[model samples]
Target: MTNTFSPLATYDRDAVRHWTYGTASTQVPIPPPTGSPYLSDLSFVSGANGWGPVERDSSNGEQAAGDGQPITIRGTAYTKGLGVHAAADVAFYLGGNCTRLTATVGIDDEVAPYGSVTFALVADGRTLTTTPVLTGDSTAVPLDVDVSGVQDLHLVVQDGGDGNAHDHADWADARLTCAQ
Candidate 1:
């Protein structure tokens, strides 16, 4: 037996916006030809985010690296106050389970001068292996961490250096895709 219902709708080809940062930015929705088109109101927040500036052993710079970059979701930094990291809203759910996460960024002057976009896998609200921090120099630092056994996976953000603050992360957009 087959049942019929209204079909899922797709946004206008030019309706949805894209944002990004760091280098080779092509995802963020810059000042629109008319108005703001970069804002999102999608449901489902794949997050375990929390951030606060503090003096690590060396009261120098901040963290813009792994797990750190993705957690920053402040809109005041943007032209229209759309949050600092653009990728905080964009996400994908797939395979009846896994929810893939992706992010893109655009650099500006307000960002910390030294840091890297950090990604971490959290299980049962516990700390896991802290992988080597990823620097802005590396783009699209993707993680294939199996979410099949996780209920909470977090992506944090911060800077990188020999305990010195020099780099910054001007984020723009975030997107997600998965195959469940």
Candidate 2:
């Protein structure tokens, strides 16, 4: 069966901004504004561990090289896929006049044994949504958060108590919509 999604937000794609953690070093250049639907890529850092670009799906061996494309849903675009290193916990600082945010989190499919991970959306120390657990076999966990009027939004993914054996966690189709 195929997955379908309702459009999440409406805005001028040309006005959207973009940025990536550290540097824009992924295999695929970050999609242009016309193709993007949000602000910058948000800075990312894993808790004392390493981080890397989200790999292409299993089609590309899920290698730690290229940046994945935005997962479009019902005509709306989402965040490009991103991943972090093993045993690592990572967060993205999505700073803007965010009204709504949505995305999916899960382990990259190419990893062997496919470890576990958790996805959390946080704003001003308040916990918005924390997924139960995601693995290779698990469908991407959906995150739809009401961040209206929020100035700072944080998207975090961490190891799921399994020591990050194959913890290539991905922030798939992640996105933030701001007020006009």
Candidate 3:
């Protein structure tokens, strides 16, 4: 006796040929950055709790500070101007997988360059050659870094300037990519 059973089709013929991408487990593991040691190097070089302390404008203003990571001495972390002066920096040692960095801010894009909102990735409080590259304007804003050959990266925030500075900047959703 022969038995015949139908198997589920993972794909349909000619529906659309696409690369098989492994579904990243929705059970995303939360990267470390908690209390006690407010400055932990679990992700990068040195993580911080707060990155800015600016003044209050008639408009609720805010900006990011800096990032933390190892200046591997082989890469140049670059930052592009976003919305006039908004900038973002990343850690190079974080590796290629550690490219995406997201910062949240609210400030008038027309303000006279009172100060800079620099949310950067650093290693022991300094910008190294291995820092990530930042780009974009205020409209579609974000700083994407390439941390492919790096590790032990951290994030920080700092007002590029002071006095008549703005306030309010919350950074989160920092995703690190790994090099294959």
Index of the highest-TM-score prediction:
2
lDDT of 2 by residue, 36-148 (tens): 24332543422323344433331112334554333422233344644554444344443445567776667665563467777777776688888887766676667778876
Off by over 4 Å in 1: 1-96, 99-114, 127-131, 161-180
Q: What is candidate 3's lDDT per residue for 1-180, written digit by digit as tens? A: 123444434555589754433432333333433321211123222222232322111112334433222211112221211111223232223322343333323233334222334455554344432212222223213445543333445444445555224322223223333333
For 91-174, candidate 1 gives per-residue lDDT tens digits of 212222334433343222334333454444344455443345544344433343444443434434433434313333332343
- For each candidate, the alpha-carbon lDDT, in order, equals 0.32, 0.53, 0.32
TM-scores of the models, in the order given: 0.33, 0.57, 0.33
Clashes of each: 51, 3, 39
lDDT of 2 at 35: 26
lDDT of 1: 0.32
Sliding window of 10 residues with minimal summed lDDT for model 2: 27-36
Find the candidate with the highest lDDT and give its number: 2
